[model samples]
Target: MEKIKTLNFAGYFRNFAPILLLFFITSTGFAFQDDRDFNEYSGEILNNKNGKAISSAYLSLNNSNISTVSNTDGEFSLKVPKDLMDATVTVSVLGFQSKTLPLDFFKVEGTEVRLIENVEELSEVTLYKATNARLLVQDMLAKKDENYLSDESIMTSFYRETIKKGWTNVSLSEAVVKIAKSPYNSSKKDLVSLYKARKSTDYDKLDTIALKLKGGPFNTLFLDMMKYTEYVLRDEMLDSYNFSFDQPTKINDRYMYVVDFKEIDESDPWYYGKLFIDAETSTLVKADYSLNVDDKKKAEMMFVKKKPSGSKVYPTELNYQVDYAQNGDKWHYAYGRAQMEYVVNWKKKIFNSKYKIDSEMVVTNWEKYAGDNWRSENTLIRPNIVMVDDVSGFNDADFWGSSNIIEPEKSIQNAIDKIKRKLD
Candidate 1:
């Protein structure tokens, strides 16, 4: 549970050496807002005790279905309908006391919310004689139908992927997607169709080589471990990794079982991470994992699609995180993030090129829909296609209409303003 928020995009450039600015740089899109009937409120959630950012805090309208999670930087944006202006909003994070206030609280006070840590009474734990983490995971999968989403549903998600060359934001691609999530019992994959997309890239910043993400949103969705149990928790695969239980914790007032895992078999490449399971139902609450790239050559083959033959490419880090939130009886996918860093070395170059790729998807809205409505045609994107190249330019302010989106940071907002002026 002590994972670091590594990829803070706003301050990414400041951490490294100065970037070589290109005169003809490409800009981004605006922080979309609807002026007619909705008021968009932006805010940051922080720990009241230390003032540190509380990443991934969930905020929801007290009586409405509208909600959004705070990003890695503890920032979140929500558009309140004119009628709901007087409604109360509740913010909750694990191990912290929930905070409730009127929507006007943010409107007047302007956006910094501090939540106090919850003081829990510790009780003595009685350990069972047979404590098998693998068996518990198997039980989790066995009860998936009861604890997880078993029926097909449509999820409105906001997806974004950004590429950074050294300290420069070389490319950024974003899309609002409609996901046809399949039932947990089926082997069918979730389908993603692009609803609206926008992108901007500076080829010169990336050293003339386009840094395209493979599978894009599809990759992020698979990070939902419960949906793709075969990727890690299969019966046969259980023997390949070592699992042990750690200290128990609380999430949303319920206890959780922390199971830490590591690869024991070195014959094949694998991932090592921890799984947070709901103690009451054995449901997968959250997963934070990273691939073990001990074998660089094999790992490179798995990640790279195409590059200059003379150049050497390898991945240094591949980290992933996924969170699921409860609605009523079943839990559904909430948020996912993947961050990877790679290095490229040319035959006789003075400096090796370093690039970081970050992709994240958040479920903004969801509802029950017919499974047969899944898009199966040409909606699927290929691995070779650069997502930015296929998307439309970020030239429209009303790009999303009334749909909700993860609020962009100040840096992104400034870039969008500059881009809109250039277009004008």
Candidate 2:
């Protein structure tokens, strides 16, 4: 967790529209434009048995790096060059049967995709001999080099961050970025360059204060614990937590050893979470974790960077989820999401307000680094750059023209409509 910068919009009413520009030296959009350069496939992923939405499922192209994650409603829209229409697409999730079809199978009007629960895969799974979850986790960490990406590459990712007052959104920011990704075997950090960005914020509705997540997409990127071990778990940091076996499970078609972990060391901030490891390869497939908000002070330290002297903020929720997708024999970051909620207790206010902030990103495309070394210092985004401050309004047609992004959930869609109305 980098930092969650909290700023007070005390004078929001003083100006109808005030643009906030936040820059930290150390730190760090919707509507379909008809894109001629690429073809768009739209679909809703549903559970075959019950017809339920499956959120965060991975939808990707075959034999290519293009990919996108399903939204909260199990809806997705993926874009690829017109020439790739003959390529295949696969939709997969944690406990569902993966489905693959020709790219042309999806209608321009959108397609309905249903995945069966992987019950067959789990039918005789429990019959296997039990193994130690802790050891499985250790082994997953030990084999990271062989199981994950091995070459330096450049990745194109779609990133978004939003803040809501309970269910109503106060801000929405999105960007298409190019990341100079370091090899998983190396300790080097990834560098990001902004390609295109757009934002819409309803500051007037925020009442008196605004909560902003610092580092934007970097918050979720750091949750790639397999690559950046210090953020969560590492070989040497394993001793700080307690690990135990949960019920074994299956992801896609592969067997997985599920393990739950909890912080036991009082010397550090507490956390509890689960790790899904590939049974055969001992590779980590997914990680779901959160800060133990039992300690108010510790949770605050992890999120709150600054706030007004007159207000007290208490974090109610802080959690993260990161998933990996396979390319050949090695896996790389596919999708990541971070969510947080907190209550603001103003000194003189009679009622406290609770606000939730959510950020998610998925790597849509990537390839080995080549051609011009585009690492010019001025062309990159700082780790703590506040994206909402840097971009304004949903006025860019070019942004929607080429990016493959998660479909906005219904609530967020409605929020955007209302904000657009007000701005109009």
The model with the greatest lDDT is 2
For candidate 2, the TM-score is 0.89
- Estimate, for each residue in 1-424, the C-alpha lDDT of model 1 and write its tens digit: 2221121121111112222211221222222336577777887899999989888787877666567788767888887778888899888777788888888788522599999886754223442222788888888888988888788888878887877788767777788777788877778778766666787766666664666565657667878788878766766778888889877666666677778999897654577898888877888888888887668787666666466666778787888888887778888888888888888887878899999888888887777865453554325443223454533356766776756677665555655665566567
Query: Model 1, poorest ten-residue lDDT window?
Result: 6-15
Query: Candidate 1 — which residues are off by over 4 angstroms?
Result: 1-35, 62-65, 83-88, 118-130, 370-385, 390-393, 410-424
Q: After the best TM-score superposition of candidate 1, give how far the Cα of residue 98 lies from its true spot, in angstroms.
A: 3.4
For 341-380, candidate 2 gives per-residue lDDT tens digits of 7888888889988888888999998889885646754267
Reference-based TM-score, model 1:
0.84
Error of 2 at 304 (Å): 1.3
Q: For residue 405, give model 1's deviation from the true position in Å.
A: 1.8
The CA lDDT at 386 in model 1 is: 42
124, model 1: CA deviation in Å? 3.9
